[model samples]
Target: MDPKPSARVRSRTGRALLGAIALTALLAGCTATGTPSPSEVPHATTPSPTASDAPPASDELVAADADRPLEAIDAYALCRAQTYAFYPGDFALLEYAPFDEASVLLRGDGLWFVYIEVDDGNRPADLVESGASNCIVGGTIGEPKWELFGVVTRGEDVVDDYDAPLPSA
Candidate 1:
């Protein structure tokens, strides 16, 4: 076979190159003013929290063994660990957006609330409860004095409900 491309193939390649050049020129002319049109600007398909719309900080300051009745920091750490274990590899929680940190709050009723932002559709409440339960070292009849409630969300939508039973670690 000849090393040179066939005439038919050469003609098709030349046409494709000319088509690309024409498209580039058309786009350049459309943006000749150097500023992109409103239609040309990319828009977000999902709602994200802007600087002013950011959620309030955690209800209480959480630190390991802080001067609090319950060790909230430990529970939060274990919850994150369990979350990582539940969703390993590509399905990990960190793989999703808006999951930079969790909002942890210890309510007056001795319930710990952990809110995590995740784009994934599934809720990992069992993992959270399992990790948090570890903090309940001793309680009446093996029942934990403090309970954990988890809320998983994506943008403004609540993907996971908080009806999960307490999981023993």
Candidate 2:
């Protein structure tokens, strides 16, 4: 049989446990058990490319209907696929309405942003986490003819406002 822990050792161990518990609570937001709750830890988002791909020697965005938001989403997808390795299959999101929240982080910047939720080729079996990730596409909204400002987030984690803007001319 081993000897019992000394009073000093017990105190140190208890202090360590308390410290760990405090850290867990701090990070986990509100949890009765001091564990990581689902909402506490926001899901991670797919990362975006650092630099944007330049337009194909043209400033005009070719589309059947420039007024249709779907067309712009398609353009965004097309542009994003070129830079991001994981893509092409995320087409279903083309129908979703754009979530405009681009300038929140970069206030005073005249550019407006549009966001779309992406389906990153995850099979039905792979969706264990069941979290949503949105992509950021920025441009001059309300312009008669809109040009693709850039692909910001390809369904990546957005901060105050998605910071990643893959600017293409």
Count steric clashes of candidate 1: 0
What would you estimate as the lDDT of candidate 1? Answer: 0.45
On the 0 to 100 scale, the lDDT of residue 68 in model 1 is 40
Tell me the alpha-carbon RMSD of every candidate: 19.4, 24.6
> What are the lDDT figures for the candidates, one per model?
0.45, 0.43
TM-score for predicted model 1 compared with the true structure: 0.29
After superposition, the stretches of candidate 2 with alpha carbons farther than 4 Å from their true spots are: 1-86, 90-107, 121-124, 127-157, 162-169
Q: Which one is best on lDDT?
A: 1
Model 2 — which ten-residue stretch has the worst lDDT? Answer: 101-110
Task: Give the CA lDDT, 0 to 100, for residue 22 in model 1.
Answer: 90
The parts of candidate 1 lying over 4 Å away from their true place are 1-69, 90-101, 118-151, 155-169
lDDT of 2 by residue, 51-100 (tens): 46533312134332344443344534433443343333456432322334
